[model samples]
Target: MTDSTAPRGGKRERLVTSAGERLHRKGVAATTLADIAQAADVPVGNVYYYFKTKDDLVRAVLEAQVDQVEAMLASFETLPQPVDRLKALVRRWDEMRDVIARYGCPFGTLASELDRRDDGLDLEAAGPIRRILEWAEIQIRQLGQPDARELAITLFAGVQGGALLAGALRDPNLMSGQVRHLERWIDTVAASSTQS
Candidate 1:
């Protein structure tokens, strides 16, 4: 970027955004620079100008996802209670249930695929997931629970598992059910936390 205020609607950003779409739809190994270039409406040669290699594009997509997650979490902070913030997070995921049913959880799918490789990207792949779970832990702790970390894990694990099954079965309703159950369950946890 030329400056912090520069509009990110430029070719480079298009490439990264297009790459994220393709990667989420068609996994990393299957998406080519040409595919991203075509999707972004940039010439194949121009892709090399913005990204030296395919891995560079993948890393950029991961970084973009991290920024997205942070911005979203920051937005959730505006809610009054920790439980409300937590439900908002789940609601956010619920909003994407249809897409997740079609393409799986982008974060989970990409992270799992990258873990099979020896490249340093495996660590980068964990960045967004860690941030989400860590954010959840903070919220759970605010409920005055000593087992905040465990509860956070429980929350994330259940959601991720729901996403996986929703994708595998190509059923958005499955995710809807899961999220509804989760919201009710979070209420139960919150009620119990304050009591204990």
Candidate 2:
């Protein structure tokens, strides 16, 4: 018999996608298998067939997030100039200001929540953010910044801080403002590189 829970893709894929979205909105500890099943339109018992445990599902979600971050970074690389690439990244965030204001940065909020749990997957949960930071470092390095790594950290922190504040205040403008400031900072850094 064909499974009703299965979508055009597959039940497992749907479950993972549902879990990731729920986890982003509800967090790891709070999101239950039942919630994922409901979101995916699958039976609760069928969830166990795909993921033996909640941790297993969480790992899958993190892997999906890593893939998303890689794809985003790859898209940024298509830009001709490093500064333009970084600006593209900022613009990307600015475009998501509404979502960020509602739920904050998925990776940042998830990492913070998982870190607080002191669970073994804390590092795993942080993998996506780390990759983003490393990608930013490479972009900054391409711009010939002597402190590429430090500047990347600053950029990541600024984005995360803006995400946190925007979510707290429910203000999309706050995130847009931060994105504009970051774009200006990128220009300043680029100019300094030329002068030095």
Candidate with top lDDT is: 1
Tens-place lDDT digits, model 1, residues 1-196: 3753223558888888999999999999998888999999989998887777889889999999999999999999899899999999888778999999999888888888998888898888999999999999999989888899999999988888999999999999889899899999899889888645
Clash count list over all predictions: 0, 0
lDDT of each: 0.90, 0.87
lDDT, residue 37, candidate 2: 94
Tell me the TM-score of model 2: 0.93
Root mean square deviation (Cα) for candidate 1: 1.9
Regions of candidate 2 where Cα sits further than 4 Å from its true position:
1-9, 194-196
TM agreement with the true structure for every prediction: 0.94, 0.93
